[model samples]
Target: MSQYWELLASRSDDQHTSEELEMTAYRLAVEQVLYYADRHSRTAYWMIERYEREFRQALVPLGIDVQVNRQLRYAYALPKHAKAGTASIAQTVFALVLRAIYDEAASIGQLTEGGEVLCDLVELAEKYRLMSGKELPTKGKLDSLMETMKRWGIAKKSEDHGLDDGEDMAGQPYAVVIRPAIADVLGEAALARLVQFKAVASANDEPEAVTSVAEEGESQE
Candidate 1:
């Protein structure tokens, strides 16, 4: 995580405005910290402390430690409401799907590519274990989720594909272009983690497929 923060901070040096850097730092802190907490099942406070420490390490060298406390406070506050309130598991599942797609794109440098698009929703759902087969959401549900993603600026619709085409059309896929707003907020390392997760998930998926093939071969024998 420290390495990622360093990469983002370095990227920020020439291109980003001071305010943007500050915002990036805060966003990275919140997301990465929460991710660590979620993975380790640690309390949010522990995550906050780790985030602050990493942030300070990342910022102090840049000669911009003045707003560190303010940013830390904001970062720490993000998980408070999330932790106390009940969140829909469906929403969580959908977000994980989005994250996986974002990661896959990033790994291939598609996130930085101008025309790179999102993978189809059905394919994305399958990759993330959200759907067991080619089953897609109803039109209403699909539209609702697409609209939500658009509002968040994590995704947008291309005129290329339509809902009527079913599974075959799923191959045409939605292109996921990274929003500058989110890229600006999250920095490179956090974005890179998405890529990392995609690789791990891909590796995990391959083994299951291999095992399934072996079983099929055994049955044939």
Candidate 2:
């Protein structure tokens, strides 16, 4: 890996450095996901594409698996054998619902040009009610959970106007854009887990199925 880094450094342009490359790798280790289309992740995404081989070798010892989806133009790090999602019940439920929305839109080709599904809060609320038989957490609680979703590269806020003075917000927009990475991060099996959680939560079983997908590794944001 040291020799590979040296070679990359030698062939690199003055605009980027070996140190930058190393830091970018660390950023991937920490951030877990990077999208080529995301403005904030463009540099890191390019570095990963440029030194794909080195990154795969470097991350292996850390028990990380690199998944580069050229179709979606995103890179994600999956821990080899651990819990892949660390969202609490509220957050996990939101993620699961959002993933469902994304899948539904994708089936109908309703996704944005960038392959993301733009969803309204009302849709989220409706889906949440259907999935868990509970009311969606309102105001700051919902907003905070969205932030966590964005941090984990699953979803992001767009055209958000915050909560209103009252709770009669039927058509208001607390819209979220579901990222393509969500598909890779949470597959069909995640929805299955969501079903599992619903049973657990309904049974007053102490919310046992907190982890979204993985089995052993830490998958939280």
Candidate 3:
């Protein structure tokens, strides 16, 4: 495993050098996710695709599971026993709503070529309230919470989506552009949890149950 890169590098001139692969491996470890549709990560994503097997083998000892979503054209690494990170309950609900929205878009074949989905803030608030039986945070607080989603590689801001002009976020209708990564981050299991949580909320359950679900279903790597 130590010489995995070298072994692959030795294969052919077409094979990238050990140092190049090593650097990519390090980046993947640090970043945890890459998408072919992301310009900054395009090369790195291709590199991983090229050496998927070696990368998987090399990462096994580190308890890192590498998964590639072929349809979505993205790769992500999951750390053993880790949720993307510790997320606040608000963020957990936000992710759930985003995931549900993404599913709706995907089902209708409305996903962009990059597998991104557009979500208006108004719709987001509506869905958030519907799902959690709580109001979405104010714009200011939402900004802070959204950083968590960005860090988890599940969502991107409009500016990041190549918005025209130097349009100010405050001057326009805010939107949450969800990345394809959300599909993997919060899968069908998340939707199931939503049904479960909705029932709990309807029953006027204690905070602990909902809180526990949020903590457990936090975004994935």
Candidate 4:
């Protein structure tokens, strides 16, 4: 854990009256990065943008690599030697599907200004069915996956937006708020790979064709 004070001391040309305030801001930025590995909350993001240089500089001494996307208004930290992804295969696939859904929805203007989108459980069930060619998971399993997504800063139950998590929503519509952080987690590179993999898989899964009598004669020749 690198102390922000240490970094500030090393870089401060005018270490006057605002050192303590700046230190507090730097520490808060670090905590924000730790809590939200994808993208910090809006308030935290603004603060991070204001102190982006300090945040990056502080993490360097501690052996942590950080990525700041100014266009997307987000920042995240990477451990010195972090693994590629933090989610299980199922979780990762589900998240990728949500991202695809988000992109599709946004194309037709279904997303809000904050890049937040609402996706119903019924819609998700249909997507899962299509993706796996099987029935949707049990409510318990679905709920568990959603909880894991929430922890990962992917999606969350938005009761304020008329979303619910009870059995009452089984037949009706039940939605989750897909957070903007999902874009940072599953960026363009990963999505492109997924598309390529899907195309290859689809081609491989096609049924084989049988040759007729004329074709057999040609093969014999």
Choose 2 or 3, whichever is better by lDDT. Answer: 2
Cand. 3 Cα-lDDT:
0.71
lDDT of each: 0.39, 0.72, 0.71, 0.55
Q: Which tens-of-lDDT digit does each residue in 1-221 have in candidate 2?
A: 66666667777766577777778888887777898877778888888887787788889999888778777788888767665345567777778878888988999999877788877777888887777666777778888888888777888777432324344444565477788888777767667656765665552223334674332123333
Local lDDT at 73 for model 3: 82
**Would you estimate the TM-scores of all the predictions?**
0.36, 0.82, 0.79, 0.60
User: Which whole-number lDDT from 0 to 100 does residue 49 have in model 4?
Assistant: 62
Q: Write down the lDDT that model 1 would get.
A: 0.39
Off by over 4 Å in 4: 1-3, 6-43, 60-74, 78-81, 160-173, 192-221
The RMSD of every model to the true structure, in order and in angstroms, is 15.7, 4.8, 4.6, 12.8
In terms of TM-score, which candidate is strongest? 2
| Candidate no. 2 TM-score | 0.82
lDDT of 4 at 98: 74
lDDT of 4 by residue, 13-46 (tens): 5442245535445554343232222333555555
Q: Which model scores highest in lDDT? A: 2
Per-residue accuracy of model 3 over 28-64 as CA lDDT, tens digit each = 7667678887788888888888778878878888777
lDDT, candidate 1, 40-68, per-residue tens: 22333333344556456564553422122
